[model samples]
Target: MNKKLCLGAFMRPISLHTAWWRHPNAAPQANFDFPIIKDLVRKLEDACFDAVFLADHLAVMNMPTNALKRSGTITSFEPLTLLSALAACTTNIGLIATGTTSYEEPYLTARRFASLDHLSSGRAGWNIVTTVNTEAAYNFGLESARLHAERYERAGEFFKVVTGLWDGWADDALLMDKESGIFFDPEKIKPLNHKGKYFSVKGPLNIARPVQGWPVIALAGASDAARQMAAESADLVFGNARTIETARSFYKDVKTRAIAAGRNPDHLKILPANQVYVAATREEAYRKKQVMDDLVHVDSNLPNLSLKLGVDVSGFDLDKPLPDIPETEQSKGHQREWIALAQREGLTVRELAKRAAGSGIGEMIGTPSEVADQMEEWLLTEACDGFMMVFHSAPDGYDDFTSMVVPELQRRGLFRTRYEGGTLRDTIGLPRPDSRVD
Candidate 1:
C-alpha cells in the first residue's frame, strides 16, 4: 500500500447551489470563463492537492422538462476542453476528466486520453463512467439508453480494447537508430483485433503509448457493474458515500473483490465524496449553509430528482411520505445513500428535500477544527483512503477551503505539505506501466 491520502475536488463550475449565481460573491459566468478554471487549478496545486476531477456525461442530465428549464447547472463547457486548459496552467496536480465507455469508441477514447497523458506528461487520468442517463442515448442519436446490465457488459469489453490498444506499440518500436537505417521495428508493433459484443476494433491506436502505459483509470462507484469494473480494472474508485461505516464496507468490498479477481488489493484506492461548508465558528458555518439553502429553488429541483431517482416525486406534498417509488431489489446506491442520511437523522421528507438540492452529497458544516475532526476520523479509521471535495461556490468556495480547511488537514498530517512529484502517476505512486509488447 502507498500509505498516502489522495485529495481531489469533485469540481463543478460556479456552484450546484441553484441561487449560487445570484450570490453577491459568486462568479455566475465562470463555467465558460477560461481564467476561472486556470485560477482554480493553480489554487489546488498551491494547496498541494493531488488532482482536480471533473465528472461528465455525453448529454444533458435527463431532468423532466420543467426542471430542465429552471436549473442553473444545466449546461457548461466540455470537460476535456476545460481540463486541457487546466493542464497548461499547472505543473504537478493530476487532471482527471470523465469519459464513458458506454457511448464513446474505445480507440477514439484511447487516443484522446493518450494525447492528454502525453500533453500533461502523464498527469492525466480518465474517470470511467458507464453513463447512467438514458436521455444521453437519445441525444447521441441512439434510439434509447442501453439496458442497465448491458452498459456494464459493454464497459468490460471497452476496457480490454482500450488497454489492448495502448499496448499496440512497444516503446522500442520507435527505433530511432541512425546507423541501422531502420527507423522503425515492425516486430515490436502489435495490432489488437478486438472483437466483442459492443465493439470490434482492429490495429494499433493512432497515437504512441501514453507515458503512463495506460493513463490512470478511476471509476465512479455505484452499481455491481461498477464494483466489478473497479475490481478488474480501475486504479481508483470514487465511492459516493455519506458515512464512515458505508465507506469502510465499500473499501473492504472492493479490495476483496480485486484480490479475488487476481489483482493487488492496493491497486484500488477508496475515495468517498464529501461536501464542505466551513466558517470561523460552527454557528457561522450553519449560517452559511442556511444562506446557501435559502438560495436553492425547490421547484427547479423536484423534477430533476424525480427522473434520476426513478421516483415521480412531483405531485407529493413536500412534507408528505414518499409514494410510488419503484420496486427494485437491485441497489440504487445513491438513492439508498440519501435514504440512509434521512433515516439516520430522523429527518422529514421536506428536510431531506432541502439538503438534497444544495449539493450532490451530505454536508459537513462547521469550523475548520470541526470539519477536520470528521475528516481525520474518516481517513484514520480506514473509512476512506481520501476525499473527493465538493465546493459550495467556484473560486470563493475553493479559496475558503484552501485557506481554512486545508491548513487544518495539513496540521493533522492528513494531506500533503508540498506536492511530492511531477506527474500524476508519481503522486499516485504508480510506476509507468510497461508496454505489453515489451
Candidate 2:
C-alpha cells in the first residue's frame, strides 16, 4: 500500500572491507578498479537501485599509515573523479559523492556536482558532509579543528550559499546568440553577494542549473545539529542507527521539524544505514558474517566506541555493564539515538554494540527474506524512506548481496524493475525544480 522506497549504496572508491583484499575472490590489485566499480554500477542498475553513493574524507586516517593501508580502506580516489568514470560506464543509476562543507569553498563544490549532473545526463546526487577528522584541519591550513557545533553551523551556511549560487544563473541566461554577439543575458544573471557568518561569495555559477534543478542534496548526519540541517536542507538524510524503533523515532523527529519549518514532511526522506549479508540459508550467512566480524580488532574498536559514547570503554569488560556517559553538545548524537534503541529494546550497551557490529553490516544483516522483511516493515511503519547500503567488505560483500538478494527483492515487487528516467532526480521520483532567480 505504501510507495516502495528506493535503494542507494554507500561506498568508498576502492575498498570498504578490511579483509576485502583477502576475500579470495576480491580484487586486491586494482585500487583504480574502475572496471570493478562499473560492474557494481551495472549490478545496481540490474536491481533497479536509485543510486550508488560514495563517501569521502580529506586526510589519511590518523592511524598508522601502513595499518590503515592494510585495512585497504585508506584514501582511494577522489569521489567525483571516480564517479565520473562511473557515469561513463552506467546509464541510469544515480551517482552520489561526499564533498565536505568544512574544507571546500561552495563554488567549486557546486560546480563539480553540476558538471557531474550534466555528464551523467542528470544522474547525480551530492552527499554533503562536515567531516570529523582532525587531520583535515591541518591539511587545509587551519591551526586547530573547529568545534563540532561550529562546523555544522558553517556547513549549514555553506548549503544556503551553494543553493543560492546555483540559482543565480537563469534558465535562459546562457544562449549562444552569435547574431546578437552575446553569450549570456546579463539581465538574467545576478551576484549572490552573500555575506554569511562563515562564508562570503559572489556571482552566478559558470555551470548552469543542473538537470535536477540541482543535484539531489543528501545529508549524512547523525548528530542533532546535523539532523536539523538534513531536515531543513536535505533531499535525503542518511543515518546509521541500529534498530527499527530508533529509526522510527529519528524519522518522526525530522519530519516534525520539517513541518514546523514549512517544508513538506515527505520532502525529507530518512534513510537509516543498513549493512547486509545474504545466502541460501540464514545460518550459513550468519556463520560467514561472524568470520568476517572476527577479523575486526575487537579491542581497537573500544576506543572508537568510547569516543562515541563519551566514556572510556577500555576498562569496561565486554561482559560488564556499559557506564552511563552523558551525551555532550559536540559528540555522540548518533549514540544518543543508539541509547534510545537500547532502552526501547532492553539491550545492554555491549549487546547493542555487538548487534550494531554483528549485523555483520552495521545495522542490517540477515538472510535475504529476513532482511527484505525487515526493510519492508520499516517502510510500512514510516521508519525510513530507504536504506543507504554500506557494504561491510568491498567487491564480494556487495557482489554477494547483489547476486543473492536483489533478485529476491525483484520477485517481491518492492523495488523497481528498471530505472524510470535519466537524471538522479527522475530516478528518485523528485520533480525537477523550475529555474528561479529569487
- Cα misplacement distance, residue 301 of candidate 2 (Å): 3.2
Cα lDDT of all candidates, in order? 0.77, 0.74
Q: How well does model 1 score by local distance difference test? A: 0.77
Candidate RMSDs in Å, in order, are 2.2, 2.8
Model 2 TM-score? 0.90
Per-residue lDDT tens digits of candidate 1, residues 310-344? Answer: 56666777776554456342236776676667667
Candidate 2 runs further than 4 Å off? 13-18, 29-32, 64-70, 297-299, 303-312, 315-319, 326-331, 337-362
Highest TM-score model number: 1
Root-mean-square deviation of Cα positions for candidate 1 versus the true structure, in angstroms: 2.2
Please give the lDDT score at residue 94 for candidate 2. Answer: 86
Q: How many Å off is the CA of 147 in candidate 1?
A: 1.0
